[model samples]
Target: MLNEEKILAILRLQKCKAVGDILAKKLIVHVGDVVQIFREKTSHLSKINGIGKHVLKHLFTKENITLAQQELRYIQDNAISYSYFLEDKYPQNLQHCVDSPILLFEDGAIDFSNKKIISIVGTRNMSSYGRDFCTKLITDLAPHNPIIVSGFAYGVDICAHKVAVQNNLQTIAVLAHGFEQIYPKVHKKYMQQVNENGGFLTEFWHNEMPLRENFLKRNRIVAGISNATIIIESAEKGGSLVTADIANSYDKDVFAVPGRTTDLYSKGCNNLIKNNSAFLLNSAKEIVNMLNWDLKATPKIIQKQLFLDLNENEQKIHDFLHDKGKQILDVISLECNIPMYKLASILLQMELKGVSKPLPGKMFELI
Candidate 1:
């Protein structure tokens, strides 16, 4: 009963998720009329006023009818979440986007409740300063546990993600294609780590290619998802500026980390700042402090309080290890739900106190 013709007809619509769904629902509503028309009861529905030839042509076609059923089955089985404009879970701020995706495939725990989210974007081909700044910035802001968002591109995006992973924060990559394939296959290992530690999200459906247009289109989602956007380092041209502009259009804050004015990589950021289009951010702490993110956690268990009492930020850290036992840094971040940098420092203090043990692969256990 799958309508292969209908499927092909729908596909011909091109990027028609929302549109096709609407049209399909309409067809269902007129099923009686459609059956009659197909059975020759109405002598060619095209003759009926308001029944356009195009719609009638497709509607009566046996191929389209079969394809329609197939598409319906595919949609139902995939369990894909469509974030239509009317959906309750759809982000309110992103509803007005011109290039907004009609559907999104989400994986992992996504919390839009976080009031403070800043996009850490930069050039794919980054320099030493960009790398060092990103690491230090993310580490410093680990306490606030800002949800890190970025394109899972080469260089800066992955660097930021690596730091975020190391710090134990939730990071989401907005892919240029569907979730079926990952761009820059080299990051497959890192992406797996992201899924376990954070998650990867996308607007394109499964099997979509990482086309150039998709990347440009996906940048808007990156800007839309966050409250602010930051550019670390970019040449005078590249996709980073595109994200910054989208952020501005969305009325979201745009910030740029200043680099040496003379540096080639700094040109895009410098121009953004010079144009007064973006705030000049020197460090992650500034972004954290500016956003007023609530990162400090209140330990509820008696053991946590007792452990805190036993040591200052340092000794109390040992209590986590001694009591909870050894865990990989990533595992601890997830289980403890704490940022990686803070977890590491807390763990380091325990190690120095001789109350904790360090294992291979950056794991720690109680001594």
Candidate 2:
């Protein structure tokens, strides 16, 4: 639980009209603390990059302070649970997102300790085939016990939630509106089950209605909270595609279930696969393999290599892989401070030298 003062400051910054999540984060980083952002002088704050006249003007407005205080009271009176972005309770995957909400309000018993989170989304008018694929996909993934994250909308999102519940897996519903109300109204029936199983997460304030833009804003949360996003079905223009695009932008894995070319709902998914925006999803196994979910069950013990001819960067990578065992290619690049383009060639050179080998799913290990 966040201290009341900290949550109040976050709320104040969040309610600032001109400051978005990115700008809010910038301010926090420059100010060194959320509470200090309010205490700092306007002229001093103006010196920070991205803090413009508009931001300075609305940042500490009395109205926003009043609103934050009211919302803080609402949170206290309602006993609502929330996570600050800087806190451990915030989902780790989401914490890495640059634009993730600074203050996320959560309801229900949500456990993000299990990091294997998958997001499933699609059109509201899901076909029978889409329904079947959605059901079977979550069912097969039950053994993996990944948290199922989805929009709490009609069709694919609801199906994913219900199927996850049936399989005894935790399911999270990212709501576009506040907890005061549920969109589509019909989903209210499933709230208790979802609450008991997983929970609903949102950044909206209490009493906020489900507006069109809110759903678009909510998509980022859905895409950000999971390791991968799977599209069960979608039309040419749909929110599911938007979510997939967001996930891709985040450099997260995206999967699209293919259907007949003529199928209207599959067009968006087909285009995604064709354009290489997403991988061709056949079953849960592809997700499990691509994400290396099953590899965690058995740890690989890599032997430290003896003296070998290697460059400084190559040796750094080799020592890293040797210490960590099998690691994803992106992780290697990040940990070793090598760019992806350079890392690929270096790994290939290492492969030729017989110092390392490539594994399934872009993974590398010391040979």
Candidate 3:
């Protein structure tokens, strides 16, 4: 059974936006005694080093307690499960975050601990090129079977999720709002599809809206969950840059596909490349080489045989990956002339067959 009191404790702590580890340390006198503070409402919190009467008042106030209970019950009733920061099932990658969410709600069957993960983020008012790049990039990376992570907003975010699901790749959308309701009603179909394909994740409980600030708060998860972030397109100022900045802060690699100099959408990306904030990538092959990964030589295998198992579109990917050696998703899509949406599924089958591998920097390598 879930620890109800502990759950309430987490909800209480989340109100302050304090780091989970910091809160945990300050709430308990010692490591062994940590669970006690969460298990019961006691004066122990008041005795903890940094905690004050003011903080405690907010935590134990009648209104706050009522709200916490309501949120917890909604989660429990919906069968939405969450793992506390120290719980075994919590995302290990996010565990190191200074402001890591104390409790994360998940609604999907996919495991976050799966092999490789990458996040793709960009502006909401994306250009045609941005949309195209998102499709193709994910398609090429899909074969490596990395879990795709994003914020699930409009533009590149929704595009990423669509491609990921089409490729049969597991995708996780970390939302800023509570799980009680999805923010954009337009994404209802996509959200339902993702539940069966990957899952929806959030730190909020129920009935939360996607407020402007909430989206910003959610950027941490997008950066924290993935090994790297691929910025397909952005403007001078937008949410895409926010994710990129967060990714850099987390010490994760950021890659951008350069666009025309005059294109406003490309300005942010080109600036990133110019300022050395990101690597200028044109192919997954370059990304693979940067990561220094080489699939060890094996018996000469029949390439056409692998192609035979794939659909016409999938076959194109097999040929493309084989010819390109290893490349970024954007370049491959251009070279092969494949649509991003159609390419995702092809990559999925290849990943399952060990024909390709997704790398840390949003690149894929052919086996």
Cα lDDT of model 2 by residue, 1-367, tens digit:
7677888899999999899997887677666678989999999999888888888989968999899999999999999999887666778778667788989999999999898999999999999999999998989989999999999899999999999999999999999998898898998999999999999999999989999999999999999899999998999999999999999888899999998999999999999999999999999899989999888576766455677999999999988977666665645765677765578899999999999898754667877
lDDT of 1: 0.68
Question: What is the C-alpha local distance difference test score of each model?
Answer: 0.68, 0.89, 0.73
Instruction: For candidate 2, give the lDDT.
Output: 0.89
Judge candidate 3 against the unseen true structure and give its global Cα lDDT, from 0 to 1: 0.73
Error of 2 at 122 (Å): 0.3
Which regions of candidate 1 are displaced past 4 Å? 1-14, 17-82, 96-98, 294-367
- Order of candidates by TM-score, top first? 2, 3, 1
Residue 207, model 3: lDDT of 81
- Report how far residue 185 has shifted in candidate 1, in Å: 0.5
TM-score of model 2 vs. true structure: 0.82
lDDT at position 128, candidate 1: 93
Work out the TM-score per prediction. 0.63, 0.82, 0.74
lDDT value, residue 59 of candidate 1: 55
Across 21-100, the per-residue lDDT of candidate 3 in tens digits comes to 44553353232333465455556556555667666656556665677788778877887788876555777667545456
Which sections of candidate 2 miss by over 4 Å?
A: 296-367
